[model samples]
Target chain A: MANMAEAVNVEALGAKQRRRFPHINWLALAMIMPSVIALLLIGLYPLLFAVSLSFQRFLLNRPQNNGMFVGFENYAAVLNDPLFWSSLGRTMTMLVIVLIVQIVAGIGIALLIDSSRWRVLNWTVKTALVIPIAMTPAVVGLLGVLIFNRDFGLMNYLLGLVGIEKINWLGDPTMAMVAIIITDIWQWTPFAALIMLSSLAIVPHEMVEAARLDTKSPWMIFRHVKLPYLMPGITAFMIIRTADVLKLFDMPFTLTRGGPGVSTELISLYVQRMGFRIFDMGVASAQAVLLLILCIVLARAYIHFFYRTPEAE
Target chain B: MAQAQNLQTNLLAQQARAIARRRSRIPASAWLQLVLLLLLLLFILTPFYWMVSTSLKEQNDTFAIPPKILFTPTLEHYNFVLFSPSAIVPTGLQNSLIVATFTTLLALLLGTPAAYILARFEFRGKRDLWFWFISNRFISPIVVALPFFLIARDLRMLNTPQALILIYLTFNIPLVVWLCLDQFRAIPRDLDEQAKVDGCNLFQSFWRINLPLAIPGVVVSAILCFIFSWNELLFALILNRSTGQTAPVQAANFMTGFGVKWGEMMATGTLIVLPVVLFAAIVSRHLARGLTMGAIK
Candidate 1:
């Protein structure tokens, strides 16, 4: 076994040597330098700055006492603040609910589209899905504003057409959250659907056919065959969506402005309010750091749980 | 025995014909799927429809009690949004175009070569470097927004289109790198070796050989980069408030000032979304991979 391992290592080393060309390493480093430098200046610098700012007492409103090292005071304050906790709770609620709704609806829609026999309808639905996914979130929010208008809005009008009373969609707190969720679902469900559709496309035709030959039900086939193929893509979508929802800002910012008295205030909005609106950079940075940690942890956890090597499988 | 064999074959043929007939006819479940998908399509397209329709409606007609389903559509709002002197959108659109174009160009210039090296070369710390590039995508914009604002302010670059163009690279370059790395990987390494034998340098081989073959993927990346830069709001909102606002920021601005100008806002919204949706449709086939950062593909 030791001799075999040594032979493999020698062979790998020989392969590496053969792959190398004269002056390649320098060229590679030179080629990659500009991007690395750019990222370092813009991306890494700000990240480090935010970390440093989190440790300091920096307030844009009070420049006189700026940059004073405050240890964990900002972090402690952020943890103690009811607004922080509430906004975090709101964010988690949105994340969980949005994930569940989008995943289910997306998979359902994808399955329907996949199973449909009409090529035109399939093409049309797939084409239509791009609009929402491509729409600018700010515009989506603006559309929400117009659609959810109390008196002249299309939503209320349509609701009234069904003989329902006009509901103050954005005015009431619960309804405001509901409105945000609906707009989000409307915009993002397509994304989820598209991902699932692609995943469904990879479900082996032969496998399904064989399953059918075995007299398996469609549900059984999907549960046994299609689902395993969908899991990785779904998990990836979950990670991407989780990162997005944690930083959910643009749509809700324009839709409710964290309004109806902060009912719709997500964590990103909270940080924006603290950092930009209230100009409390220290606490905001602390919160940003915490949110960053949460995102990394969740992403790592998801990968750990769902990500498996093909060999392992 | 011959009669029995014939009868069995006849029964099998009858079953095949029955199955074919069933397959040819649309099932109830299929019809149900059609209805559900049509409704889903409607749900997806309604906002777009509303935005365009509202953009065309007159100011008074915009808030009509029944919501003007059949009004004479007017271009007055579009006229005001596009041609009027007080319009914020055209400049916003221009700034958006300039910033997105430059950001794409710069990101391509800086990222494509790096992506090539990352794809083809086996170097020390390659894994770390690749992860570093990708991990940039995971950082929230808010975390960087404040520091960027401060840095821009310190450099006296605030409210300049250059500020946005430069800052957008922080994300766009990573995106370009991530997407183009996959593109470069998909190309055969034998092409590079052939170019080398023909006396082409490393850069020439990349520029001439791999890049042409990877052009489709590069264009996809470019389109995605342009769309992202075009649609971004938070950085544009913070970094470029008045003079350098993008179209999305301009659309959002309409919400903040005075009574909500639904007609004008929708007009702006329509304008902002039109190019993105069009571009998205053009590249819709690759969007699943792009959105997932090439994980699915």
Candidate 2:
């Protein structure tokens, strides 16, 4: 084994490798120096500084003399607060709901598209679904706002045609969360579908044919074959979307302002309200660190079950 | 001889069964396709139709006893929003454009080269560096807003275009670098090595050779960055005043007025939403790998 490793050893070529690839082009490094520096100072340092700020009171008015050590007190405070707990609870449940809807829609749509041998319907529906992806969450939220606007919104207009009473979408607490969820489905179902469709399109034809030969139903084929194959993409996307949906801000903020009495206040929105709106940096940073931990933990679990590790983790 | 005939009959029976099974499922398959097609149409068209229909309604007609789909459409709302004495509609559009242009230009200017180096060079902590940048996503925008609030305050950059440019970079740079990074990396290193040997300086090689190769990705990234910055409200709201608010923030503000300016806000919403949706649909449709500059996952 050692001898085999030595034979294929990459670093063994060392000096010879440098000579062969001999173009470090220090000038590229020279031009890159400022940008690299700027990224470090601007992009990187803020993250580190923010983490530290979590431990200290970096309040706006008290900027000069506010470096008192408060060890986990902020985390403790956030934990004890019902507002944080509830928002987090809401965010998680919402994540599960949105995720289930998106994934099912994604897998189902992909399956439909994949099975249809006809060129016309297959191409048209797939093309149309991709349109939702182009719409930003902000625009989607605005669209939702227009639709849900109680007095003169499009949704009310539609309901009027049906003889239904106008419902308060952004105003009522129950309706506010529903409004956000609908907006997300509008924008992101396409994303989930597009990614899943790519993976589904490549499932081995022979395996599917063999399954069919064995008298498997389409549902069974999906449950047994396509599902297992699509797991990795689904897992990776879930990791991304979970981290994202947890930070749901733009849409909710725009549509509801976390209002109708905090019904739609997600965690990131909660943190922003604490940090920026209230200028309570210590608590806000603490809130941020806790969120980071939650995200990392969730991500680790996702990586474990679904993502093949770089180190096979 | 009898056993061989039996085996041949069984094989033919299996083939027939397979064909029969397929034939039986054909109607069901067609029915399934029809149902899915209807769902797809409803899913895509409902909101779009609703948007145009709402935009067409009279301001008072919108809140009618029942919703009016067939009411006579009027240009009154559009006229009110666009030409109203009170609305800063033009300023909002201009602010969005200026901020978006500045942010996109700067991100491309700085990000493309850095993206190139990170993509090509095998540097130390490359992954960590990449994560360090993309991890900006992980940091809630609220966190960014807080520090920048101080930074902005300290420099008195509040409400200034430069502040938006700076704070916007907190998120936008990583986005640009990540997107451009993949494109830059896809270009073979041999191209750069050849440019170096041809007496091009590092900047010259990067600008003259590598850049042209990375143009498609850069333009796509520029579109994404512009759309994001244009639509960005958290920072735009914090850093700029009403006079300087980006289109989305401005539109959002219009909704906060007494009883909400439904018509005006929708008009502004339509303006901002249309371009971005089209751009994403047409330009940034590459289902390729993310534009990460080699470091971040």
Candidate 3:
């Protein structure tokens, strides 16, 4: 019966489309043309250019040997480069840790706020959450520099109040990574919380009430009732955040500039160093292509596993 | 029988008293949750607070041990950043304004009609087109930054505001298209049909009937585009170094020089952040939808 109804609906929609508009919809085509052209020129062209550039020896500084078609050599070099591997390693480490921390803390805070009865408090918290998201990452990095300063920074000052000795946050290698992680968490955890809070707000009250009657435990209620509603939001967040973390440039760029000694260098910074600072466009383009492929594969995998259409629901 | 009646009456009174007590007192758990939320709010606001405080403090007071909670505020840093003869910030601000405003306007002009088409019409390759637009968001900016820089240099467009404006469209147009698609979808299809019966063509129906209704969503997306363009660092840093530096890049420039002018840098940071935070607060309710490309909402 369901399948038959859906078939009828589809047939009716098709018939209506045929009656109202032409099969080609010329007006629609015309309207979308400019944006399509712009996107192609600005978006797709640059990507294709980069891909083509990756297969050559394009040195910006030494324009003499540039544009020599060294097929696969650049990719091979990127693969062999230890800096490439280490930066990729650092990026993945940060991605895993940041995603985990943000998701857990974000949802936990959302649940806390959602469970509260005060309307004003919810509004205030949500409004406050927007500040971090609004902050420019580069400026945030500067703030991180100040907050993590070894001598007179706020982090150490606060620690001193509790009798803990000051720690060199950006000076030491391991500690610099930690400081970067903390700054990232501080800046973005609110994003997770706000998104999750919005998700939690839409949880079906009747279903939650039914679950409450079944068991007094909040844990069981959340597991059975709220988690399902929150899944799509979480999945969406993961897809977006994964892409973002993979390409993260601004905050770390300003905060540590990939180091006291290259310890904090992620893939994007590595690419920047190669392409701009070192003037090796070929290697950078190769790394960029690889990163692009990784993003597409991960996004596709996420949609395959977790994304559900309204029809599926 | 009399003793049984008295026992029942006593139980009723006890139940009433318990109800009254519960009504009079708040739950401890709720109090704890509220406290935690306030702490989270503080955590979210502290960096901003620090930025503003340091921006306003005298240079000596900025580095005070224990970080002075109370100090004489000064506008010297702000004056230096805004009015000094050699100041780059004012020019950066102007460039940022010009680029961001134009980017928002153009993205909307080009994106809205396409969004309406995608939303209301059924066409071949629509799904592919939509995906293509959205996937632009996921592409690491580094991929395009170098190529764009080379192209800009070749065309002599480097250090020009136009370069940043054109490059930002790669992301902003997609964002506008996605956000407005959701908005257009929410409007009833019957309105378009009504306009059609009233002798309106497709474009006229879209412009006259639907566009007004979708203004709020359009404004939200515009604000977002503006914020993204204004706060953008990498493209602005790369494409326009001297003549067309935006506020964020100017703020970043403070770090490159010797002795790091902390006060002036904080002031620049404050200027860069102020408008974005205000716009963000205004659009906070619609933000999750915007940030997630309307997927979650």
Candidate 4:
């Protein structure tokens, strides 16, 4: 998108140079003004306000105190709180697990589809994969609840058929974490697959043939050839998936509600509970600012790596 | 020479097949792949199948162990979801439709002209202006939820679809701007110049010339905006606490209040998934492209 935009802008510049027809650049500004103003009011202003709120003591529970200048007190307090640290830790853990599983499973599916002999089979698999991608994450959470229902859920029933014991997928704290992870994997693996598949479609056949000519082992061929081609897609997947997982609210919110004593309390859910339910705006804002920083830093690093790596070329 | 060439070509063909065989490993790899693909499909689609099946099953059948793979399907849950006296589905659907439609329209209205300008004309700080508009997409909704709530409360727009529409514009406008910028850029500048030569001002030329060609982008953005609003939970959950709950929030409500109503929840889940899934299928490529922010081809 950026490439196309830049290309067009350059073309337009050339055209403008050729035919300087009374340029009204002000009209361009006028055209964009509404969006600019709306974004400032609704988007940028709220963010700045949130940052400002993070520095003040605006606790709803202690409404007797107004927005006093706490001056980093909320950050200090939040940093000291074990729950905040634990939730952040848990969120990081979830991010790693979900990202790793989704990318690996996604690449596997992509390779499987790429290697399919029949066109019909490939199309069917691709269509089936994307179905999960389109489903609402909240519904996916609810679906997790039903699927993990101990007595009647298909999970237990299928387990029974395989002579395994019934497990409390969501009731047990560890299993609850596992359940959310599973739900997230199910929901997003297809996204990874779709991206990898598209990228895989563009992997040069000549490179693959050359690799085949050089190596008899499939793993060697893949390592030397296909993996390099897939790196960009994988990196893009990682950046996007990691950023999203950090803000995971809907799935865990609906599935476990941070579950069985804060085990699944992701950062977003933790912040929401703090800000809304507990009405600790100061602490919540502090946590949110931290999350925003983390996301921005992570996205920036990945984007830099994505662009800087000559391997993508 | 012909015979020698034929022999060499045949030798290469056999060598190629041998390498292909080594890559494939087994002669029955196709069958093996088919079976595995079927299993993967089952893994992916069963949740949906279960969702739909549970929605259709009789209340008892939903819980039947060795779960009923086949049952006399019924619309009892659908009936309950749609027709129950306390049914929130109808209300939720209405709210979702209203909010999503207006949000899409508003985003398009506010985003299109900006996109056209970015596409056609050179300006100062154009890159910065474009970044400011589209970067809102990366801001987590949680970061803005409370401030927006406070803003809405101050403005007395809380618990209304309008609040959702306006707050949602934070991302929707960016999305529209980015998507439509690409679309507008794809149209040649010669057309605009020609239209100008024929006595159309910039706005007229844009309206009569550029806008019509960019309908597909507008439509795609509209669908995306609608889906985002429809599936949105956090803002709708927080902002519209009571009267204007969207379908996603309403579906979530079924899980918490009272004992869990499995059938009706599934019914609601099915309902929520159906429209978006249909929309995604109809424009699946566009949907994927949109998610990547048009970054990937």
What is every candidate's C-alpha DockQ against the true complex, given to 2 decimals? 0.51, 0.27, 0.56, 0.43
lDDT (tens digit, per residue) of candidate 1 on B151-261 = 999999988989999989988998898788888888888999899879998898999999899998899999999998998999998988867788888877877768877
**Tens-digit lDDT string for candidate 4 (B1-297):** 999999999999999999998878755877888887888898998999999999998989888877888899999899999998978898988998999889889999999998888787665566566655545656788988867877887888889999999988987998898788888988988998799779998888888899999999999888888888778899998999888889889877777767788888999999988998888776676765677665555
Per-model CA lDDT versus the true structure: 0.87, 0.72, 0.88, 0.83
Q: Pick the candidate with the highest lDDT.
A: 3
How far is B225's C-alpha from truth in model 1 (Å)?
0.5
Residue pairs in candidate 1 whose N, alpha carbon or C atoms collide under 3 angstroms = none
Task: Encode model 2's per-residue lDDT on B96-133: one tens digit a residue.
Answer: 78888998888888888888777776655666666556
- Estimated TM-score per prediction? 0.91, 0.83, 0.92, 0.90
lDDT of 2 by residue, A110-144 (tens): 77777765568777776667556655456567677
Total colliding residue pairs, candidate 2: 5
lDDT per residue for candidate 4 within A1-313, as digits (tens), equals 9999998899899777756665556666788899889988888898888899999888776778858999999999899999999998888888899888888888889888889776887787778776788888888888999999887888888888899999988789899998888888988898888888888888799988987888899889878788987888887777777778876888788899898888888889999999988998988999888888876676565546543421121
Q: Quick one: how many clashes does candidate 4 have?
A: 0
DockQ head-to-head 1 vs 2, winner: 1
Q: Output the number of the TM-score-best candidate.
A: 3
* Minimal lDDT window, size 10, model 3 chain A: A304-313
lDDT of 3 by residue, A1-313 (tens): 9999998899799988897775777887899899999999999999999999999899988999899999999999999999999999999899899999999998998998888887898889889988988899999999989889998899999999999999999999999999999999998888899889989989989999888888999899988899998888788888888899888999999999999999999999999899999999999999999998987776565445543341221
Task: Provide the DockQ value for model 3.
Answer: 0.56
Better of 2 and 4 by DockQ: 4
DockQ versus reference, model 4: 0.43
**Model 2, DockQ value?**
0.27
